[model samples]
Target: MKRALALVLSGLVMACAFGQGNPARGVRRPPKLQLFHEVNLSTFWHQAIIRQLAFSPDSQYVAVKLDPVLGTTELVIVEVLTGKKISTLRSPEYLGMSQNDRVQWLDNQVVFLGSYYRWNALSGERLADAPVVGWQAIFNQDRTQLATVENVLGTPSYLHVYDTKTWSDKKIYADGLSIGTIAWTSDDHLVMSVGVTRKSMGKTIAGHQIGRGPDVGPDVALLLFDPQSQQFIKSLWFPARARKTAKGIEWDISADLMLGISCFGSNSVTLSVNKILDGRTFDIKQFYSDQQVKSNSVAMVGGQACSADGRFLFIKDVDSWDGRHKASNSIIDLALSRQVASFPGGKEEIASSENGQFLAFGGKKGISIFLLNGE
Candidate 1:
């Protein structure tokens, strides 16, 4: 009887120590964020830099591409709420020897295009030892269709379309010598970078001027097409010729609004915007002048991203031609006509939501998201 009483007393003491004062059974609440919470997203995988990131349409998951390792790149889909990894999309079998070029959301699914590889996120499949040639664009608004402008090394250029659901492909055009980037303005219409002959280097094709530089090979402009008419409607200068080198055309979206950075003269880089209506153009405004941007100096030389809603433009500073560190980049709120934020630690890549509510960047400090709450 004495031993039984002693054991019962010990059990009571332990229960009181563990369960009496704790409201959550001792689990701790996360610390509150002053500016913003440093959400720990490091547990989804091992070491590898994420090059590009995009949130799903519903904002439930974030899809990202890791820097190449073991001659292969990994695509991960992470749950936003629980911070748990939902799926990893990767394949060394298809990539073979190509590197990751770019990835974007085609509606609900993900589509990635590499040097010679094209991947479908929903089916998680790749081309079987067959490489696709040239630059491609997805309707983005519609998930099923993809437009590719191909110019085989020595052959004339051709426009092709691929239906993601059935993998059924059909060539749209085969008469052009070279094509740049194709964007679908509507289901019945497409916008493509149409180039002129090699001789039209220093002249104007339509109202758009062409550069006369020694490196000037193909002079091209953006053209709108009506699938029903099977003819070009109008052509205009591709926003910036100076900014585009081997990487092809500057960043563009098919929405009604468009923004571009162009170098007009030997020393001026201009940021211009235009709104399209009924196949007609209206110049909204030119926000930045040559004084605000400089080549090989204040401006970054790589890919830039605008918010899906087209409010903010994030550009990475290239080099210190103007005596600034040239390492850190600035985020511009075009609607406000001012630079709102700067990331100074190191060079980074940025991607913003359509509404600019959330901004994501990749840098030496790892990937980070800045939540923009209107105060």
Candidate 2:
């Protein structure tokens, strides 16, 4: 009887810690968030760093990748509601971007990096290593295909596409090097973060600069491409980084790779936003009070997330140069293009469910699953 009572008490404590407190008892505050599950890497590894937390399509589970500690990494999948460990995969080294590592899911199965390994979350079944492994993998909005872009010295980056279900390399493109990062347009076309120098029909193509970012190389532009024909479609130089909305994505433009008219005073930088619905552009121009002229560049917007109703847009922006690489997020009222709330972090590992119902924040200590109230 005593042991059973202790177990019951422990469960109650966990519920409250997850923000699932009873309203009658006043256990939670306003806009209470329910913790779906929790994961602290220190429990299994002597040292752990939260690298990324990606939720499955159905939002039933989350796949977490811990940074490679002393050269070994672990990927753990846990049930969102029950906090049950479905499976775990170990990688000999870091996968993709070491700092912002990620995991991709296909048809609910979790496909991770490490010896080209794949695991099924529901069955806990592990697939054999593939013939080849690609780095810097990204998925389309529909999640039907995955693309791996590989860059080599003195050569253009190559992109390898894999069918999500069969994990087969379906297409290969040589234009990957032109892309700093990639996204999908509203019409199922691929958009790339590339600059003035480009490739069209295996020849050099250049753009007459109407605008620029910092005054060095070419300002990174969102170049649209039709993967089916492997042809370049169009390019736009606004909205530094795009996320969920407008079906258009913005790419980060490093100061070194951007150019403008008077990189001298650098008083203010103008950023344009392309709205998908009505084809309108919103300009967000701000002055650089924190940095010198040489260091002042376009405030790079990194992450983009939209609320379920598309009323609110979340933008993560870094204002200055390396003097402070810190990122900040502002909740924007889309209709007004005004900032509603501001927060400190915009660089941490975060993931949202397909349905935009939940947002997961991964930290060094653990992962926290919070219900998205869109507030």
Candidate 3:
């Protein structure tokens, strides 16, 4: 009976009709954020580091990738409401992989693209032998297709789309660009941040340096593409410093907004938002800046996530030298342009459910889930 219910829930999840409700609006008090549950990785193993987290499409479960110790990694599936471990898969070969190798959910099945291998979440089954050699991997809304970048030396980065059913892949788009974040906005259309290299360094693409140093690459611009026809659709808004390196990009499911981050040297990072419209243009706005967040010369916005309704944005401060470490994690109410709450020891990684009812955080400390109440 349990397996049967899971099968039914899986179908609903793929249809994107599992969770449907308007998220609560306005500023929510800190006290209203009740701790829904906590998953202590240390309890299962030693020196555990929660690297990546993703909520199931139906919001019934969460998949967590943890490095219990150096040179080892594991994927654990947990029931969200009960906080019970449903399944666990271990891979000793994934030693130095970071959160960039994410775990995705295709209905009830969990798919993980590791540094050198791919595996199933529940049964510990190996699906593919090749590693995803790219910056990031993203699945479509229905989980029928997967998209990744092929960044080979001395060649343009090519976008690869793989059909899950046939296991066949096709190189759709290729360009002399450094691709940052990649996502499928719809079944037919995809979004990505692409930037031109500063100069030709022989076999090496120039100006794509990530951490520290001068912003080598031209400013990254968000673009939309059609994977089926392999055609560039339109160019969206670019970041403020259109000549810096863009490190990350995220979509706010609730408000149809895009959040982008550009890192300057080793200490500074900027966050911006743009509302995606029906046409090609985007309504861009500079939402938050880390220029003033520095304390003792160590301040940076490590990670960020938005509620489904796009009312609240969660920002995590990493490497803050502030003695107190009081505002490690903060909740910003976008409508009011003010901070609502702050928490100490917040992780740099966060995730939210489609309905915006739950928020998940992962870090060296452990995993935490919070329930957002209506204001």
Report the Cα RMSD per candidate: 13.7, 10.7, 9.4
lDDT of 1 by residue, 30-110 (tens): 111112212233444544565666666655455666654546666666543333465667756433223225556655555
Between candidates 1 and 2, the lDDT winner:
2
TM-score of each: 0.59, 0.62, 0.67
Winning model by lDDT: 3
Which sequence of candidate numbers ranks them by lDDT, best first? 3, 2, 1
By TM-score, how accurate is candidate 1? 0.59
lDDT of 3 by residue, 1-375 (tens): 567755644553443332433445742543235566777777645756777777787787787777777777787787776667877777646733654567767666655644335556556686665434454666666777777777754345778887766647787544566566565553346666565443322222222332222343223556667777776676543332422235445322222223232111111112333222221232333334433332222223555656665556666666545455533566665555556676665466666665556777775557887665544
| lDDT for predicted candidate 2 compared with the true structure | 0.51
What does the lDDT read for residue 110 in candidate 3?
55
Each model's lDDT: 0.47, 0.51, 0.56
Q: Which of the predicted structures, 1 or 3, would earn the higher lDDT when compared with the native?
A: 3
Superposition error at 209 for model 2 (Å)? 11
Pairs that collide in candidate 1 are 308-354, 309-354
